[model samples]
Target: MKSVEEADYVIVGGGSAGGVLAGRLSQDPACRVALIEAGGSDRTRLCTVPGMVSIIHTTPKVKKRFDWGFYTAPQPHGAGRRIPYVRGRVVGGSSAINGMVYVRGHRQNYDDWEAEGCTGWGAADATRCYKQLEDWEGGEDAYRGAGGPIAVTRSRDLVPATQALVEAIAETCGVPVVDDYNGADQEGVGACQMNARGGRRYSSSEAFVQPALARPNFHLISGAAAARVVIEGGRAVGVELIDGDRRRIVRAAREVILCAGVIGSAHLLMLSGVGPAAHLRDHGIAAIADLPVGQNLHDHLFVPMTFLAPTARHRGTALHFLGGMVKEAMHKGDTWFSRTVFDALGFVRSSQAERGVPDIQLHCLPWSYPSPNQDRPVRPVVDKRPALTVMPTLIYPKSRGEVTLTSADPTAAPHIDPHFLEEEADRRLLIEGMKLVREIMASPRLGDIVQGELHPGPAFTSDAELAAELPNRIHTVYHPVGTCRMGVDDRAVVDPQLRVRGVDGLRVADASIMPRVIGGNTNAPSMMIGERCAELIAAAH
Candidate 1:
């Protein structure tokens, strides 16, 4: 045991949500806050590039330092293949290394949370928080907020295929094109709104953390891994951090906030003896409280349905490079290549006929997209040919999984069992989604542009074929949630205000607390959670 320094608040994990919370809480000036991050700073050039995210994914130098590099336990549903789970280890967390798509999801997704024991977290309640964090470049309205820290802009590098897909889907499905998916209605095809400005990535850390670093009340400690929450008599006191061979304990006078993400946050709670008693006993850790810490893991599973386009107009790999150049030249009033290459995109409900909410989501990229398991090409080969890639994601999965401690060590990654494709319905819906993608691509509007299906080829046209091929092709959308779920029920890990039911002065403020995963990209919602958490904590004071 070491002498601990006390602060009004101690926040674990200075990633997406934590960054916002730290910034907001320390704004009170009167309160001293300490934000501990397990990774280093986000000063790398790789993190700033909006179009080069895929390049970073394949590079070992960046991956080794910035990524947690976690892998799931062998999934029984996916035929025993271990799913790779990448979480951001840097100051911005996953937002520092994500695709940068800024989606708020369907409003009903949050309303459903209120229905499921999260009383004040309904769409109406949560949207305000979402609005507060965004500085929408498209301008402000009732749905979007202005003068906020996080810059949300439309992508500058939209490819032709993406625009074609949006137009095709709208014409074929009769789903009207929406200008903003984060607006009045979420179930439509339109351009994807992203967290980009001036052709650069705007992560939460960049938007929130960087600015807050100068505040005297705010203390940000990077490279400090929170080993466990220090609890005494069922209340969290602070946390223990491991630095080299030295252990340091820090105390929080007010509360110990856990924003360690779905996997990290839940693992810390369990390590602090806040999970299932039987499991805790087996790990040789005393159980302070028995709760379902990692019982309800959920994620959106996706299968890519690629298409080969006719003519050399598709641009393929050149689109990213050209898009960058067009953006740069456009800054200098050169619009020569602007109209020829578009970054247009859209989203639609997977099953529009059966829908109360959207089940499938689509993202179009103008390139010869490869699957996650595919090896990177050794050299950049421009196929002076047309190509397009459409990714169909299963948004609201019926299948559920769990995360378990492989070892009691806090540094060790947990066994994540997402159990993808376990439910027959999930598989059936995915097949339908794939067919929908094919239909959208084959629409009269896009038919003239596309040559044929490149993946799930013409040979495997039937639903049975899709079912057989999907298992081998499917990968995660990287939107895992519900592990440290929030609800009033016994199985719930935290309550409506995000406080651990059996414990005091501790709460989870991340995607893990989501009772159900949102309908679209989760980065925006995660930041909203952080913003909302700050409000909730401020109210508590």
Candidate 2:
């Protein structure tokens, strides 16, 4: 074993949260900052090009370079089979591989955080943190930011099918199209905003970390996979790592922060013997603290309701030498299904009767697929025949699962169990959401473009038929959160300050600390946590 570099802040995971945290903390030239990423650089061919997103997402190279490609334990309520779960392992993390959809979730989400004992995290104060990071294309407003690091653009150059879909959703829901979902009204169909610049995907590494690299005090190390945090008399002092066959340690003088994401952070803590006492003993590890390190896992669940439309062919991009790539920014890549895959989005209430808050999120894709099988990861159906897939997701899920250690080996993947639709309420809402999407599909504006239903067609009409089909039909919306949950409770792994409970000089920042799953996509809020963590740590100095 060899002791390597030392820094004022030793940050684990050069991911979404870690990138932002390092960028903010290193602004003070006096402090030395280091960010370690297990994966390599973010400048890959597929990652850099926006239109090649599908190839990157579904290819074998994904597991090797971009994603961790974790698989879930067999879900009982699901098809009784393991589901493929993808988490980013690169510089920008999932922000590198995601759909580039920029959703801040609802104001009620952060307010709920404050109400749950996370002080100074209400929507108003959180908005201030957002303004400091966002460079919104929609211009400045009370809700939108104008001059910030991340460039957020509301999608333009929509296909005619997407326009029809949005119009149809509005007609069915009786809500007008609101240009900005991140703005005041979040309950209508509109072009989804993205973290992009001139039609290119702009990940957090590009947005934050790249700028801070100019400072001599800040440093980034790729392929430095963290093995464990060194705890000296209950204070986290450094991070031990596996660099090839050689062993190394990067000591921290001020704080050792864990931004290893929901699964990665919690898995590292357990390996360091800071998880459930009995569970740690099973892996032949001594317990540092008998805390619930991995619990309260939740995510958005959706079922792709497929439809065949002859009118969709008109909006489909034709393969041409110069006209391919679809986006106005790129001209030489493959023709994408649409300029933005998730060009149109909708928010609706399904779980509860309340009109103000939405429990369902609708992702409208202009291309279609055949009847999906349960053996593999879900991908968009690719064919010349124009089709559409409307995936209605249960934003607020009741089902809970966990991430547990398979062994003490840091290289071994953790056992992930999202337990999809385990609860009866989650199952009920899944049916309700699917039904609502069907109604929107049957509406006149969109129905005018329809050919027929390819999945759950006219034959499977009853509620019972749809309910029975859920085990094979439903899939993840790819938003996993709440593993190392934060609260003032006993089961909480981190406190409201994000400090790891029962330890000093250690804090967890990322999606893992979410007390409850927010009502929308989680990337934006995860970045917000990074901003807040930086402020809190700077205050202590």
Candidate 3:
């Protein structure tokens, strides 16, 4: 035991949720807040540039500097391949390395949560929190918020290829172009909104944590991995952390909030002896509570299809694109770098007769890779020829997986089994999304430039063909959720208020608490969850 520190509210993981909670809770002069992050600082320029995201992550070519660099266990449904699971290890967490897309998801997603035993988490509640968190550039409206901590603006400087695709989607897919996807309806083609301000990526660290650094009552502990939560008499008293060569204990006088995202929060709970009793016993650990901690794991998986679009500006090799971006940056500064390549976004139902809501999400990028396989550490070089890629992501996947301990060693990574493409409905929806993309590509605006299909070419036309090849092509969108689900049910690890079941003075706040994964990018929703957590804590205390 090296030393011990104290705080009124001790939050583990200095990511999106943790950052917001710490910043919000520390506003009270009487409260002393502490945030412990497993990773170090995110002061690098790479984290601020949207175009530099791939250079930092998503692509296997880049080294893992700010990423946890964990790999999923071999998925039988995913061609038995151990897919790379990238999560941010820096202060801002995934928001520091993500594509910077800011989507609040469909309003119905939260409404569904309320219907599913999550009281006070309805769409109305979500809207309130979102309004409080956003500083939308589009100005204040019924739904959009303004003058808040997080800056959000729709992409106005769309590249030629992206602009063409956006128009083509409306023309062919019959999906109307909506001004605001985060408003009344999310089922439409829209410009990609991002958390950027003044031509720089605005992560939660910048939006929330950075602003609170000067507060005398707030303390940030970086570069420390949490060994386990310190529980005494069924109450979370503190957390034991491994800070490099030494170990330290951080006591929480008020509460211990776990904001370590899906994988981390669940893993930490299991390690702290707060998971299924049998599973913990198998790992030679005593169980504190037998509540399900790492169940209901789900994620959005997409199969990217490439097309030969000769007119796209960002065509050619990675080096060529980098050189051009660098040259543009030298003259234009952050203007060109702030806009991420995935600028065109659309949400559409897999079948028109199914429902009014969208089941599949679409992302259009004006760039392509040599291979569609995005397996970890194996850099698939970008091609020299011009191309456009559309990734049809299944927003609401039916497959569920779990995260379990590989060993009792806290330093080891957990065994993650997302069970991608395991459900038949999931596979079928992805196929429909692919067919829809083909229809959009065949439109006049895109068809003129699209020379041909690159990956899984025109030959694979039928549903059976696409379904059979899905395992080989599918990749995660990195929007994982529902591991430590929040509900009033017995299987729920946390309650509607996010308080951990069977434990007092502790709570789990992050994507892990989502009873069901939302139907879009998760970064914004995760931040909103953080805001809600802060509000809940403030109300209780």
Residue pairs clashing in model 3 are none
User: What are the Cα lDDT values of the candidates?
Assistant: 0.80, 0.81, 0.85
- Overall local distance difference test of candidate 2: 0.81
Cα lDDT of model 3 by residue, 224-299, tens digit: 8899999999999999999878878999999999999999999999999999999999999899999888999999
lDDT of 1: 0.80
Candidate 2 clashes between residue pairs 3 or more apart in a chain or in different chains = 368-387
Q: For model 3, give the 10-residue run with minimal summed lDDT.
A: 369-378
TM-score of 2: 0.94
Winner of 1 and 3 under TM-score: 3
| Winner by TM-score between candidate 2 and candidate 1 | 2
Top model number, lDDT? 3
Error of 3 at 6 (Å): 0.1
Model 1 steric clash pairs: 158-342, 158-343, 159-343, 190-346
lDDT digits (tens) for residues 234-298 of candidate 2? 99999998888887888999999999998999999999889999999999989988899888999
Q: Candidate 1: minimum summed lDDT over ten consecutive residues — where? A: 333-342
Ranked candidates (TM-score, high to low): 3, 2, 1
- Tell me the tens digit of each residue's lDDT in model 1 across 1-541: 1123778899999878999999999998999999888989887766766655555676677577888888887767665667778899999999998888788988988888898768999989888998899899777888888889988876553455567677887887677878888888877777667787765668888888888888888888888899999999888989999976887888999999999999999999999999988988899989898898998899988876667775323443556566756675556422312121214445565543244676678776665555544422422233444677778788888899988888899878888888888888888888888888888887887767788887767888887777777876788889999899999888998888889979999999998999889888788899999999999999999
Backbone clash count, each prediction separately: 4, 1, 0
Model 2 scores worst on lDDT over the 10 consecutive residues at 313-322
